[model samples]
Target chain A: MAPSDSDAIFSALADPTRRAILSLIGEHEELTAGEIAAHFDSLGRTAVSSHLRILRLAGLVAERRDGRFRHYSVTPTPADAVVAFLTSVYQNSLEQLASAVQGAATSEDTPAGRVEERSA
Target chain B: MGELILNNELRLEACPSELFALFGQGDAAVGWLFGSEAPLLRPGSLVRLALPLGGLARSPGTARVLSCQPNRRIDLMHETPWAGRVVCRFDPLDSGGTRLRVRVTIDDVEVARLGAELGLLGGYETGWWEVPLGLLISLSGPAGILGRSTANCAQLAVEEINADGGVMGRAVRLVVGDDATDPGVGAIAMRRLCRTPGLAAVIGMHSSATYAVTAPMAVAKGIPYLYTPTSEPTAEHPLLVRFGETPMDQLHRALPLMAAQTGGSRWFLAGNDYSWPRAVGATARAVIERMDGHVAGEGYLPLGSQNFEPLLAAIQRSGVDHVVSSFVGQDHVGFQRDFAASGLRDSIRTFAPLMDDAVVEHLGESGEGTWNALGYFVALDTSENREFLRRYSDRFGSCSPPVSAAAEGVYEAIHTWARSCRAGGGVEPTALLSGLRRSRFNGPRRCTLGGSLESLLLGEATRSGVRVLDELPAATQAS
Candidate 1:
């Protein structure tokens, strides 16, 4: 199965550019790429457009066609997905910490493949 | 590939076929383990025996005895205290040597869930002793642990340990090197790890890196080389613990059980071109032929070989029902993908002993519904495992663990290695190695003195070395 919509949303959020788009939408409700581009001092119009595209794919933004141009808007999703993804990512870090104490418990032993000749 | 029939005993340069003949169902395993003729046994590949009478017992009065020549690669199958089965194998190489493989198919999903639910993550590490060993051998000098799946798995392990609190306040670090699966790189990785600071200890090896380069570096560094995953006789290495089970451990149980379960004897072997498959094939062929099964086809592909159409065609033409695949690393996902895509997905049922979590994770949905044999399954029905799975999923994303000793071994060994570091206080290399040697944990398998947990820890510790755990003879076990 593909990543959950929430997971996709969280993964999408990992990028700074994507986050910037969301921030822009938050500050000035439902803006198109041209309007969002003016807010960034260094980003090009194309860059802004690409960022919006990613946000839209992640379901963080909604889009509607307006002739040659499409308008972008942030669509709300269930908050629990965000919470769950964050919890999981953070929990792995915690598990790493919990592992410290467990690591002190003892020492143990543990621990292959084929030949396919090909160039990718 | 040369053999001579001497006094009715087939003597081969390497017992490619011997791997199969050694494993039998029921009393066969019980008999070999006890050094007696397996007692009168009934049909059915699995026979539950009393724990006291059994070699590795998680609880009392019960142990699942597995039997099958599922593939030439798989050589052992046995029960963990957790009531799970783990299968180990040896894949013959096209060039030379063997690739050791281990897998635990979760038969009792409840047991796995329970173990996960109980919060004792150790259950997931049962029978991991073979993992590192097999992996190190695989690196035989191809690619080091870094950049490869081994590196990825190691990184994941290290990340988990650090994220979990550095194993008792000490950073749970790994002195890793590029086995690049190449000997030179393996040596380089070993030397680097040996010199690495703040790392508790080092295990596993590179190709051509040999025990000489790795063993001494670890020993000289005084870092604990908890386990070496090679099938070569391990009793010689004092600094390096040997968790590499002989042919009788998990395979003895797995082979016959697979044979009986599938009720087919003909075999078709597929593997990468390397030492692991070579060694494994030599031993396996002997075992299967003894059971009156013919090796319908045997073929070897270059390591990372992309095309399996020839092998698949042979399998189809040979009219073989069972396909024993001895593939590893990236090839694992590739071969399995091909297996599923092949028309044989429905016609031929594949049973592999080398499928581990890292490999299966790559396979993804492609792996579901395949009739693969396992020594442990992530879905086993164990209170402890259930909790571990839930936690692991919640923590590490939803990637399910491949059932077998190694994944669980990695799971437990992280804890064991951490505990060793904690015990040593400062957690130095050799100090940690020594600490690991002296300690035995009650691991998730529930065996006393942590013998079984020891099995898993040893597997993890040996991760950096040759994959000897894959060739475990049916005689050895980690219950």
Candidate 2:
């Protein structure tokens, strides 16, 4: 994934309100703007509406429009992409760890070190 | 490997409802399970698990809450890199407390793969490909009290670097070793770190005694070693970069200001008998003499000396109105407590060059009215400092140890090295050396690496923590 896209997703997920909104929408199939706003007493309808817009822009939420109201639901794509990116970064780190230990084992030429490395 | 199930049970002193309330309180209560500053927990919320291997390497896996049943249980399903389930059950015990059972079920193959990948069980070999940095800091002995917060700051830097795409598109991993605050142990740790494959650089936050031994090893191994605590200025080496405050950096402006406030100039110098403290005494004498101040007494004791009666008696007899103490760690705390207990604190004020948040925290009420000058303080009010503290608290939880100059120096040192690597186009020793010579980073302190002068702040310790008093003028030259 492009760095910018990943950054956008992360930035969107960084906010607590947006994360709560995502979780709320994910708990059900879909929720109208009014329904989501009702869950947050401190946030007004317009404030919740703007949060949904930002989440939609980051591709974290999908919007569906009926005659008079719009419904929002969590999009699995961005979450999946975030997990994939994190997984790759971690795997790369582990690969580096393996190489470091192996390099140390090769340099020492000690049977005990090699045996411990294998067992570890 | 097909499947693996790990089960653990613990009986806690809290009731089931009390135990359940902890999870909902915030990250500070549950940071051991979830990474710090995790999103609010409810069904369907995404939670990031803390990294494995004590956070030495990053392997963050995201999980989705499958169900949360009030005080009874909470279930989560791992969503990436592997398929897994974590079930946490709280059972109210008849005996009084709560019995908590946690069962984690995952694919056995994935577990083995992760272990092998972390090099716990070595199987695959590839050429050195990632930027591996070494952190050699004191984790035991006199200076060990500051170890956890210092290491946390370094880890925060690495995570932030990775979040920002890492150094030159390569992920950075930290390899930590304990120096035990002894030069001999430091030398061994330095040698081991220097021997790591493709080690980019090493950052040391231990004493100058350790640096005297470890810096040479890093230089010999062709690795750039950034020393991140106050130390005596040594002859420049290409591979050695000193990023902390020098004695002159702390004394030049602070001495005159402190003298003006106290209305007298009879000064007593005290510190642990080490190279750094000796250098501090020399610089304090020079600065005090330039201002026509009188040096009434001076003393040096071995590190970790708990009995300060002799020192307190000497201070009382010397009739000094101001003291410049260079003691560190437990000695710093012990001396201050004894100074206050001796009732001398009411008469003579202390100016400590090596004072920091951790030391001040340990000093508690005895720390009040003491003065400190450093490159960074936890109370420093700046946008960069606020953001730095926010990220720090987010990563380590708000209740973690406050940031000290030593810890902040580690954070800045790592970022400075990363910036230099970017400027030099690679992590080669010579290129990085040249880049470091001109590297400047905007952190809590706007620092210019290898520069003679740096921005220093004067702070007075209060009951809570150090409060920034004023910005001291930069010294004319390195002492």
Candidate 3:
């Protein structure tokens, strides 16, 4: 995935209300906008609709229409993309650390050969 | 915008109560989750878990239970590497299974930084002898301005030691805990550091307020703790070694020169209301009296005080030509900026013992002409110091925060501890302690453990950085 797409997912995940909305939708197979709005006491339907719109734009949620009603469900693809990005970043960091240590070990002034000589 | 919360739920075959019992089983639950061993989870218990990073390395995570309810909920707050809260909820399902909900609320920025630290730990090669050292410094809060440079310095020292075949032929690894500049937080960080497996020593660079709380904890755990900042003299303990100068060590050498240079015998004492500052104020009063100088005024503001108008007004009214201010970190920066803006910069010469390159840079133009005395200055023209700076810049980039006395102090503290380990021929606590008493380093600053500093350098801050004015004589001979 592109960095911007992952950024969009993170930006979408940054909001508490949107996260709650995503969690609510994720709990069941699917939920209409009204059903998700019912879980939050302070949030109105309009606010819920706006949050769902943002989640949709971020590709975190998918909306389907059937018989004049809309159902919302989480798009696992985006969440998996986030996990993949984090995993790859972690792996890259490890590789960098390993190579840096190896570089230090190979330096001429204090080489691993010298260490072996001293130990002998 | 407040915090990012991630919620995950899993349906297990066991019942709610039965599943809850597994959490209290300690190693079983830890092994199940992190594939590591852990102590029993209880309220206020420190939980140290080795979180594996892609089978390459294990990142140690320390969390404390805020509250735990039997078979229902367990809430935890993560301390090190990142800051976050976790809540586990157990609910009974209709089909007799349990729906376990885990909600983690964290700051995204911390998660990104955690990835970097995990990468550093990932380079650990299996079967290599490793000496884990704890570095408890303020990565956040008021003293956070000095955090990056201090951390960088510690990292540089560890790398240098590794490049030189490590301590006692064992590679050194640093485990960091952020004190956040709060005593309570420092206690948590100290507990986490003490609990780390194979932890050899702890090097602290936070405020003395935090030191008072953490020092006893380190002593109780029998770990060698080397505190690396200016502080008041405490009762000497074998395991606890202080590398920085004391209030008397700084003021005795600095006050006379400052008095002679400025030709002012009347002085005003200002500092944060803490043990170190109070000790500095007391020492300044005595030294001034001994020299037949009068302490024209004195005041102690609480830490993190930004408004220095009242203090400035008092300093002006007291008719003192020189002031000895001991405010630390951001408080130091704020006080200096306010003093300069008050137009008092023309008449009053300020002597702050705690000021360093980082704080001077933070002051920028306002730091001009301010006098400071410390054991190490960035402007020291010595081969040892130049090499130290070169290594630091090479590792952390030249754009990194300047190495100040506080930063250099920790760098020297690590090398000194490594020397002690070499002297004792092991990394055991008693061995390290005995070795520390006789440890000497010919680094940027010449230091002997449990002895007076070889010399204290007086510096005057300029727009670029602090310029070394003169090397004052050592206050006391090496014992």
lDDT of each: 0.44, 0.70, 0.70
lDDT (tens digit, per residue) of candidate 2 on B1-479: 45555454555556778666655332432333423223445664545443331112222234556778888997876533334676778888786666666666656444543332211222222236568898888654567656667878999999988898888899888877656565655664565566567889998899998898788778788888888888889868878888777888788889899999989989999999989999999999999999999999999998757789998899899999999999977578779989998899999999998788877766778989999888889988999999999999888654355678899999989988888888787888877877777777788885656433367889999977898999875574434
RMSD of 3: 21.4
Identify the leading candidate in terms of TM-score: 3
- Give interface RMSD, per candidate: 24.9, 19.8, 21.9
Model 1: which docking level applies?
Answer: incorrect
lDDT of 1: 0.44
lDDT per residue as tens, model 1, B310-384:
877878899987776766555555687887878676666565545544444445555543333223344444576
Instruction: Give lDDT tens digits, candidate 3, residues B160-225.
Output: 899999988889988776665667556655765676677888998988888988899888888888
For model 3, the local distance difference test gives: 0.70
lDDT of 2 by residue, A10-79 (tens): 5564454564566556545689988877765567899889888888887777999999989887675542
Q: After superposition, how far is residue B302 of candidate 1 from its true place, in Å?
A: 2.3
* DockQ, Cα level, model 2: 0.01
Candidate 2 local lDDT, residue B358: 73
Question: Per TM-score, what order, best first?
Answer: 3, 2, 1
The DockQ figures for the candidates are 0.01, 0.01, 0.01
Residue B279, model 3, lDDT: 94
